[model samples]
Target: MAPSRAYVPSILLLRSLLRPLPRQCSLSHRLPSAPSRPKSKTAKSRIRKPDPQPVDFIQRGISDKPGDDVLNESGVSAVEWWEEDASGNERFVSAITNRDELRKHEEQHKRLEAWSRGEEDPNEPEFRNMVIDELKKNPSFSDMQDALEAMKKPLIERIQEGEEVDKEIEAEDEMSKEEGIREAQEFLQNLLEEPSLEHRRDQILEIQAKLTEWNSVDHPEFLEAMARLNEATGGESVEEFQNRLNPYLDIEHTALGSEEEISPQDKAEMEKLAKGIADIHDLLKEGGMDPELEAEFAEMRREIGTDDWATDVFAEDGEIDLDKLERAIAKFDQAELAEAKQEAKDEDDEEDLSPEERANPELKAKIDRIMEDPRLMERLAVIKQILTGTKAFVSNVKSAPDPTTLPLAHMTTLEDQLKIAENDPEHLIALRRLRVNLLPPYNDHPFLRPFNEALRFAYVGANDDVRRVLWRSYLKAKTIPGLIENIPDDAWDILWYSQAVDWASNQNRFNHLKILQKDLASIGRDGPPTQSVGGVDVNEA
Candidate 1:
């Protein structure tokens, strides 16, 4: 304020020229400063400028981290990337502008790659390339069960449906139709056909193998196939069929998938009577017709000594006088009848009671009750006659080590002989001894009939556990002859002891007859009868 400043216009202009250029222009050392506007006479004021920010300078086509939003002052954001797909297609992705959307898109792409490589995570929802609606429309698609029915069909049939084959057959010429059908049939047969006897012997075995191989044994189609195979290999008789299917396929002897009307035991009993009559007829044929013999034979055969013989002998008017026939035979051959009676006595005398069983109070009571019943006594006497008289008949029976070795006509005779002589003291002494070993053992007990029926049923029924138990019991008896020796005559004792033994020692040669000989001794000294044999339990008649 003291001295007035000198105004040097040229010096002021030089100071202005020396000022640095603006940032927007080139920053070279030789560059001239930009021209500035002259100062106005307005009041001087300071303009606020923002502080400079630090910048990260990244090189293109080099190491660049993701998640970085590089934006200019104009609100623009972008990043460059490279990618290669599964098909080996390489591409340079354009600079993406959005950070959130790009991150999402990248994650999805990675998941897709993992899925295509079969690296699916269990926690995620199941994913298929095709939709479910599309899968159902395809007939070829099936689960584990559908595959089972397919297994039973022949190879060609499986490859093409039956309708398709029919169509193909229809398309063929008439001359070639037979050839086509034959080829198809042969093809079907070959699916399960076995050339080896070892394999073909058992149809059940073949079916079992197929079922196991295909894991479809329980399926209905597989069952049907099994039945067809069984029918193809089925035997003519129950014995033949049973022999063919020994320790497998527990099929019962049946007619049309039902129980036999007559029990095997009853049929066996009836056959014996028929055989006896046949023997008598043959003997009469050999003896020639002496008028006295002929007249007596006619009377015996007619059950009449006179015109009113039916009323006099049967009273109930039945055919064939069994008693008169016996008398007629006795008159013809007194020595033969005597020998037969003696033999019957011998067979009935074979069984004797153990001292312990004879001493049992309950058994003694049962014995007393049985002795008191006239029906039981009469039954016992008849059995004794049959057992004692069968020796001559047995001697006449043709025999072989293997019954099949006999002629077909003789096979029936062989089976009859085996059944009749099973307890006849030759084929099976152990079982015979078991039956007759009682103090007064009958040739057969009535309970034995039902007991055997039960065993046979159990063998083929669904009671596997019981069947195994009975099998083990039978094995024990069949292998050990000593077990059958000295068993009690009472049925209850036999039934009890048989089951309690670790190994069954009964041959089951006589089925219930062997068991009935012991009477319930298995139930301890005081327990009641077990009531059930195999699956058959005895019911009072």
Candidate 2:
């Protein structure tokens, strides 16, 4: 066995030695209530389990260490230690005997010292330092989560029983807790009060030679590396990047208390940097957790008007092949392509001699005669009916209608305008000739009202005309009393109507809008409410 560092002076016991030496002590010193506690014989047998490593700590003025044997025959485990400095002063590596009590006393001392120095407020976010770190960091996250979860059951039990406790004692506990939290907060405030390089922007631009003495790198290289990885991933494929960086994530926190690897001063800095790096990696992973939704390209094509020139652009993936596009647009806009395709399909249907085919080339002759008519409206009506219902023009329901039939009515208004442009060649020439930019393309499709509205809103940002339009829509919608209740409550906050109302009110702009004005009648009925807007707080509400 290794020698005990101090020998305890043969007559001294740890608990007893804590008192002043008798006779050499001052007259004012009184005997503490020791309660005649016996040396617990079975206390040695109350051994739990051994740590993978031994306990290690520093105390006020103790340097107790033992060799690898780890413990005495007694239950109290031996401590290990290291020398403090060049002065040959030694420090305790562990305190296993009075572990919990000693640690709590130490924490209390530190807190008292901090309070004496006015370093923190009495009430801040802090818990009992039961084991140095029973509280620290956001407990809602990371490995501490399971432990916090376990505490929920006990806390609920306490809360349930607390209902029966004397109110005064409960209030005292609350007061103590509040004081502790305030102290912690004030301590943080004090630490951050000294402005740094980033805090003093102007001073940072004017660097001084003396400032190098105080230069600090808040983030370590690991944090820098994680940040670089995050940036390189384009903030999209972050999960893959985080998976790649996960190996380095918990390095600094190898063990719950291994943060002591560095000196106290550097320990704080080290853990801060490591935590920041790990947190950033977590955030990167979170940002990309939502999988990409594949675009419904087939549905997109279906939405485009088949006979509209502007729509066929949907079939192409990239920049329009201008010459090819113009040709296709001309055919589509004039319904020529649709008509030719229909004719080809009709001829093919005659192979089996279906009922539609039995009508034969005689209908073809009639179709040609009808197409030659000078009245465009009458010809359009015939084409529309033939496409919508081949049965209407054909006498038999048994007929397999020609799939090649043109759908002139299904064509867009823009297609008709293009045809008119093709005839006149000069009217609205500016609109006809204007090209799409591809990026944020202008909505020029005459029949696509919603798309036009979206483009108009995007281009104009927020305007009074849009507000008025939205207000009228809201009025119409709310006029049906049940309609408002039908809308999901979740949508109420972000609803466009709410935004438009806010914009119209300009709640923060003109004082007259939010405050009372002298010109009540002249302000007009639509100005604002005579009192606060709808009796709401008008600021917070």
Candidate 3:
């Protein structure tokens, strides 16, 4: 598709915002330092009455871009035809006074409090003189203590009122703040809704950080207003709120990591991983499995969702649960027999109906509605978007999100990887610094940018909550064979990894990774050039 007209604008805005950001995540990043903004010529041009034109350049920047205009950080003459309203000066003066009036009240009040407490610094003659001069004009404002105490009543009343109807008062102020946020968000939305711009993605991350702060305080209310605004405009940037607000709500996230972010113990854990991979390779080559089992098992790693069935066999003590499987097989066999019997008894005319016909799409739809009677459509729409393709910022690592969501299998794999790495403490150190983690081997790594893109694509159709491995598990189930003899009881992780990779490489219609990741995917399937991951025998089956 030739890019939409709005696409470029949104991309520009996103690019501005995304400056200096790094990928995947960290508690710290290459942040934009406070730019030594040139001395605003207008700063000294004190608003003789909010000059309609840029009395100074700073004012020029503000007035030049109507709060709604999508202007760059450069001097504001982005469009030649833009004009100012006739009442701009009057309104500017009024707004300025309104702000100053409140500031004056607050300053006077604070000064009185400090003087009454006798805590005013002796060296600060300017403040002392100002207080004396103000008292001379209003002699009744004598004895600083009395004035301070007099102001206290109203201050306390105001505070109580603010506290009592805080949400209501906040609701009003938030409207104005949201207006500002919306303008900014609109600009940012335009910037990001573009063709893939990896570098710009980083900049958007920072802009998102700023938005995150705003969303944290007035989340419910702000989101509602934002929703309405978005509805009217069909803005694409609304998607970013999830990224912004989600992080703010999660206290552990900071922009990225600082020098002191990781602990020694975490470093130690990472060291074991390198060695772990090698060990698994060795074990797989020498396990007690029959050749038939080994070959069938290696080839049978179906993609995505099938691992759940695999995990059911592999229990936590790290052994297969054959009895459980035996029961499942019996129950399934019985159900199959009953289904077959019912089908045989069906009217002759309907005996050949396919599964889709049997579902009776219309009836199924009606039942689905009656059963939930909720926003099933909305949820499904979101689910479809996520499953079909990642909306933003997912990586192209080996594994993908599975729907079954049992973490035991995934966790066990990571634990095993870490265990193997135990031999090399420094590598463990680097791995430990990776705090907000996912299953290793297939994980989001900044250095591995290609993987990140693939991961994002995988995330498109998955939920951030309830474990994001849906597609991996969902699709894998489709490939299960007539006989469940290929998957071993103890090799659940292997099954998961193998299946996830194959699905991504073979079945996924759209490979989101660029040249490198697509190549990585190919190389990965072949297994990383026979390099050893510190041989610690990860093979359980």
Query: Candidate 1 residues 101-140, lDDT tens each?
Result: 5675576567668877878541221222112222333333
Mark the regions of model 3 whose C-alpha exceeds 4 Å error after superposition. 1-218, 231-237, 240-417, 420-424, 433-541
Question: Which candidate, 1 or 3, has the higher lDDT?
Answer: 1
lDDT of each structure?
Answer: 0.40, 0.36, 0.38
lDDT of 3 by residue, 1-541 (tens): 8776653567778888979854643322344366344468775464233333334655655666434232334534233222245554321111112334446657877877887799864323345445544554442444475655554444344434435444643454456446545655766566567555444655655555667575542355555554554564454455444334321122121221111112345335323322332222223333232354344334433522242234333332222333433333344345446545765776574768777667456533543443364543443343344344542323544576674686764545433544444323343333322222222222233433332222333322222221223323322221221101111122222223322342422222122112112322322332222333552221210
Evaluated against the true structure, the overall lDDT of model 3 is 0.38
TM-score of 3: 0.18
Full ranking by lDDT: 1, 3, 2
TM-scores, all candidates, are 0.16, 0.14, 0.18
Candidate 1, residue 238: lDDT = 34
Ranking by TM-score: 3, 1, 2
lDDT tens digits, residue span 115-223, model 2: 7798843432132222224332333244675676564444444433434333633464355445433433343243235453235433222222222332211124433
Off by over 4 Å in 1: 1-210, 213-223, 229-248, 253-326, 330-449, 452-541
